[model samples]
Target: MLLVVAGAGAAGSVTFAAQAEPADPLAVYAARIVGDRARTRIVLEFDRKPEIAVRYIARPDRIVVDLPSTVFTFPEADLEARGLFRDIRYGSMDADSARLVLTADRPARLVASEVMANESGTGYRLVLDAEMVSQQDFEKLVNDQSWMTASVDATATAQRGDRVGQSEPAAPGAFVIAIDAGHGGIDAGATGAATKTQEKEITLAFAKALFDRLKGEPGIEAFLVREGDEFLSLSERVTIARQRGANLLISFHADTLRQSNIRGATVYTISDKASDRMAADLAERENLSDAVGGVSDTGEPAEVSDILLDLTRRETQAFSISMADSVVRSFEGQVALINNPHRYAGFRVLQAHDVPSILLELGFLSNKEDEKLLLDPAWRVKIADLLAAAIRRYRLPVVANGG
Candidate 1:
């Protein structure tokens, strides 16, 4: 075993080892982010040196670090608001690989990264340093850095390619609906106050129910973007719907509010500006799903725009508003809805440019009544049927005329 101590007066004082015995598994005991907006340093304390790979992605900008399966013993509070980064998350990406994703509030570039033994020679420390950069410089860095390496597994690359290429075109006159169950895996979304039910479970249950209901409809073909408890980035969700040629995308969610009295279903369409403060807050929380799920929020930046993309987004926004209205109308008597149920916000999951997307908040889990209703099987089925009716109403005219 090779051992050393971190530099004097560093952010953290910890001993580390460069390597460990083959029989020993590497474990991360503590992790923290230090420094200000201009510069940021990430420090990780481990039982042994870890094999790490780093890469950068653009849009909202982020740095992704891949490591061997690690046993993380850090506290959840460690992931709270940090300097330099808007948010940070770390978790197991797969059976063999773990991932740490950091979201930068502005353009940032990795300055230095290395794993060294602590000076006291007890354990290992992984240090990463980054600094803010101009947009042009960040773009160049993103273009230059490649995630793929010679050590990358060939089978994994092929599998990813196969998944992307396997999308089939939608049939003529068929109304394809992409149901996105909000929050999964590490991102548990909201939790019910009384029932302790997770927002992810609620959304998945509703999405599956709606999918099944749509299957029996004549001209409708529906599928789930995620079928199981798996995490997907907001951008990936949009990409999947677009790749599958989905005409409409409905993201199901059960959000919570600090105000326990605010307890009703609501429909949301994408907009650059939110309709209300509550809507804005909800959108912000929903958009953080990627960060919550150990995925960096490297979304496409708003300033980097194209005329054609703007036009497409405008057209899609119109359709999305219409769909939101349809759902609100359908739920008028069948289900309880929040006042001014139809709202608009900049929801990242609903930004497919072409696919008309709406986020349906089933109810607020913070409310006792809403929590009870959300946990009821009968209520779920009723809500799913109502949503299916709304979709059919929205699609019938377009599909009948071959749109």
Candidate 2:
């Protein structure tokens, strides 16, 4: 990457010249973090009718953002004081959209999201809401036992001792993980035009790998929506996560787009408008995965009761972002970043009854460099190992709590 000036008269800064020919007007992906009633929040931004998407995912804590080829103009001093973000990054993830990943000191929230054309209408503006959480309350939420109730039941069933060992017929431990491998039997997600690797297979393999690593944790366990190759409706997937009383959910997948050179790993949380063009496009594709297999979003989620549940929603959202930070921190050096690495999109699998969730696109089948990593068992295992370690570290405090 080289640096150059920006204007004829305006003092040119050290901005790099266009790295490559601009493909189609790429998406302008943007997001922010906020504090909820009790949780951390994340808000995303983008311009015009850019494709965008969002979702809430569990496990390894994080939010993912994807955008078309676009340049970020934030300055060093401004970023340093951005309290909502624990840390931030940007780089050429692929030909399209530079990815962004923001790590948080604690769980936060995503709120006050809106997208519209500027009054002048020459271009667009994306706004985000990032809130801060007090340390004491953040700790309280982390160690809370209400969510840990499942562990107590599992231990009682074992009776003999802890649920770690001894086949108690009672399955596994306290926390349940909802693993979603995007696409299914008949649904071949994005395909690599050069390598012909289907996204369905790549995602399923990654999900299973992550699941396998979570098996031995003390208060944690996991479950998959589809153990084998079969098309399960999106609602059914949600049902399965709730059925197991999961505390977290993680969805896995790889997608291909017309932007062949775009690629990198992305973590996604949930949002209605989506952050940018790429995020919106990806969310659309993922939400439509079931359609390829003859299923549809029934638009029926269980009724929300117990206003207490509302109290925890914000807390849960914060926890999700905190978790995402851990994963992003671990990804440093191990992999490259897309301009706005972490993004938001409307992902269905993340819509659980109460489970905190995260969806990770390990890489893109669309980019040649990324495609190579996605197909590499070594790379896959490395990422999975990092994820498992991060989750383990992320949960230690919770485990310490009386819960």
Candidate 3:
């Protein structure tokens, strides 16, 4: 149902009939990407042409396609590294809308995009054409769409509270926590040798359990960055936490090491240099989530330079370290701990400049004992309780200090 052809041409308008009943939504049967470094074409076959809107975003340049809520049945492997694209991700944005995001390795310009009926007249296909452009031209494109950029900025400002280091009045009895369950959709993350379980599944299980426990606690409002099996860029994860005004961001994972003998829980705070070799390797693997999930690293440029921003980053990092210490202290004796227990690494998920964040490795799936414990419902409950306790302990002092 999908076809990719070279060259480009103008597109004609098309229309669809209204549905009377709730049935199956538009379905994508096939898709393909073609072309080389200069130009690229993308074709998506569907039961019928659906309404779609396209936009461009800078700072790791991307082309975003917004479509009516549709079901995607395409194989995950089909999206692996292809021409002009580092990665492609698509998922439901909400109840009535779906989104397809294409990450480009270089600045790209949209030549044409249109939905047209197949020549045979049975179905329709969405065709998109883009080509590389100079950095100056790309900057112009971004500026031409300044209105859209302003809207995005407004949304971010509304969501984020006080600027870094600037204390603001706290919301009465409100403590927001962002729980990120690492690796989802195409990125299965580490696999267990003994149980053949995937890290994504284990992280989601633990994250959900922790969310439920926190919801029951008074004055604590907790939510997951990802509610199901969907992919989110590393930057997106941090942005979501900050947008929701999260006081603390906790990323959960269960990774496997080459050496199966190493097994235990460990907590990591963000730092320029890793605390050890193991921590550095773990951070490297975790930071590759976007690439593993089929997203191209468009490379984000540094934000505007300011002394306030620098101070805010330092304060946030300090709070992150304090939170990590609390987690290690709470887990002591309650669960098996790694030698150091607490470490530091440059984890991308912990890079929000204003939010305190930490990455928690529940245990090693490579170890038989750790795998068994990770799969046990009873053990999960105990660990979730311990984490909630840690959060409570960290929150008390911050609330008292008006941090």
List per-prediction Cα lDDT, in the order shown.
Answer: 0.69, 0.53, 0.71
Q: How many residue pairs collide in each prediction?
A: 11, 70, 1
Model 3 misplaced regions, further than 4 Å: 1-25, 119-122, 149-204, 215-249, 254-263, 276-319, 333-339, 347-356, 363-376, 392-403
Q: For residues 1-403, what per-residue lDDT tens digits would candidate 2 score against the true structure?
A: 0000000000111211222434564443444444433344443334455443322212212222334455554443433424555544433332333334444445543454455676667556554454545555444543453244335323222332221232223244475566676664445567765566666566666677777877866666676655544345566566556655555666677776687666667777666668888888877777765444332234547667777877566555566666666677887787776677677777776655355666676767767777767666666667778877767766666446522
The local lDDT score (0 to 100) that residue 304 gets in candidate 1 is 46
Better of 2 and 3 by lDDT: 3
Q: How far is candidate 2 from the true structure (C-alpha RMSD, Å)?
A: 20.6
Q: Estimate each model's TM-score.
A: 0.70, 0.55, 0.67
Model 1, runs deviating above 4 Å: 1-50, 55-63, 68-88, 92-97, 102-164, 167-172, 195-197, 291-315
What's the distance in Å from true for residue 78, model 2? Answer: 56
For model 3, which pairs clash? 87-294
Best-to-worst ranking by lDDT: 3, 1, 2
Tens digits of per-residue lDDT, candidate 1, 1-403, equal 0000000000111122122222444688887777888998988899888998787766457777877766678886765546778867675433355667787888887899989998878899999998999989887876765445213333222323434467676677677778777876557678778766667777777777778888898877777876665556677777777777777767777777888887777888778899999999988988877666445345564554789878867876777777777888888987777899888788877766667777777778788887777766677678778877787777776566554
Candidate 1 has an lDDT of 0.69
Candidate with maximal TM-score: 1
The 10 consecutive residues of candidate 3 with the worst lDDT sum are: 1-10
Cα error, residue 401 of model 2, in Å, equals: 4.7
lDDT, candidate 1, residue 232? 68
TM-score of 3: 0.67
